[model samples]
Target: MKILVLLGALALAGCASKPVPPDWQADAKGALDGFTDDYLKGNTAAAEAEFRQARLATTATGRADHVAQVELVRCAAQAASLVFEDCPGYATLAADATATQRAYADYLAGRWQGLDPELLPEQHRPVLAGGPIGAVADPLARLVAAGAAFKAGRITPEGIAQAVETASNQGWRRPLLTWLGIQAQRADAAGDAAAATQIRRRIALAAGQR
Candidate 1:
């Protein structure tokens, strides 16, 4: 996943519990709503604008924590948008972020950085552990970790396959579709006939559903 210019919902960075000013909350919430609405509607250009609006919200009446949180949201949007092949890492954002908020950045960094387990701190393990998929608290997050694991050379294709299956079972269609499309292309390039066929079929089914 490229720098998540997040094209989807789920405010990963807001997981932090910074004391937001009451006055600033309205603008922040508005920007978030606009960005998410535009993104889901496939208006990426507009989505980018809305996210920028979010950034602007931090410029006025925001603390350092608020600024970091806004950047985190922007980064996630960039990553999910797939506008670029490489998304920017949270770097200090992860380091300085609230414990709750940092995991999202850490995991995203882990994916972009190629399965570096160090990116995911020890405290984050519970969420990253489990069966076919990682923890089931959020199937999307689990799938992300599984993909990162494959890239880092920690898991075989079988491991990812199981996670993918579980994601589908959980009805995570959009993210699953997006993932399948990428995997299909990779399998095709690698001449993995079995994987390519399976991924393609899944993609086709997913497309039809949409």
Candidate 2:
């Protein structure tokens, strides 16, 4: 009697819980990874196509938060590559974003005031605390920190060097060339003509112009 009734209710509740569709999950993850890989390798057209597929898969979930998260992934990759454009996609969904997502968005945009470090990924947490960028273990995380620090006008020559090294080590040509160009400009500004010329050669080599 009572046991049977309770069992029926429990079964009904379980049936009502919708599981995530496997296809959506696979499509989203695969496309996002493809986009990141292509973008980092400087394949702009392929990255754009992959990102479109990712967005479509995420949008199928009918969850604004999920869509916003995909946008954040794109923004983070762009940040790591030193492209500091406004994260317009995330901005559109911001009102529906979770507190942590909003905080991450702000962090990517270099808006540090009132930012909650705990809301950020562990690798990015130290950046908010003014800790050394070299302390971040992951190469991509280090590049991300360097981009943020550059946005905040807080990046030093050492920080730029670390970012250049990280990108070069990873064979991330896009960011490597960008960082090398910046290093060259810094050297030129300081009247280090020899150093600037050397950096320019590295940039040319990285750009496949050599």
Candidate 3:
């Protein structure tokens, strides 16, 4: 009986280890390619539909979703006009100049988010952290700490607003801008009209002409 039980478990494990279905990758890639084509043609709805279908196909149990691929294609299509002035291939993707430029800016912002700000080398940690707070000096880590503070209402909106301004001035983008917006909303809820107005102005100014 024990031997039979062991054999059953082994068989189950073997079945579970089966390789991913070959069709999934090919189907996902094709769908992603279709999304890009539709986007390039300015068919936003059709591109979005293709991307959604591709996401579903890529979500198979044993396969990784092709989220990055789909997102890149969509970004390339939708924000083509906003590519930052510094992008390498900006000249070639000028068909939808405005959307491409925006896509590049978003791409850079997304790339910044992926970096583990806290884990940066020591010299860079203080800059990212916004100050020297021992452990939370890494700017991203400080942002997480700020969130917890906000949730607990332990830190005042005024304080968070200051941090956001400092971080934004440091050339950090989304994280700083996001926190500033949060602080503004929080101030509004607390009826601190002065603080809320100031934060809103800061956000608008930070957004610049872009």
Best by lDDT: 2
Q: How well is each residue in 85-134 modelled by candidate 2, as lDDT tens digits?
A: 79899889999988888887888788888888998877788878888888
> Which ten contiguous residues of candidate 3 have the minimum total lDDT?
1-10
Model 3 stretches astray by more than 4 angstroms: 1-135, 148-159
Candidate 3 local Cα displacement, residue 146, angstroms: 2.3
Model 1 scores what on Cα lDDT?
A: 0.53
lDDT of 3 by residue, 44-131 (tens): 6887788787666655632221334334334333322222233333333334334323333333333333335443334323423344
Compose the digit string of candidate 1's lDDT tens values, residues 83-202. 222334345444555554455555544443333434453433543453444443443345555654444345445655655575477564544565576678779889999989977887
Cα-based RMSD of the predictions, in order?
A: 7.0, 9.6, 18.0
Worst 10 residues of 1 by lDDT: 1-10
Give the alpha-carbon lDDT of every model: 0.53, 0.80, 0.46
Model 2 shows how many backbone clashes?
Answer: 0
State the TM-score for model 3.
0.32
lDDT for 155 in candidate 3 is 48
- Candidate 2 residues lying further than 4 Å off, grouped into runs, are 1-21
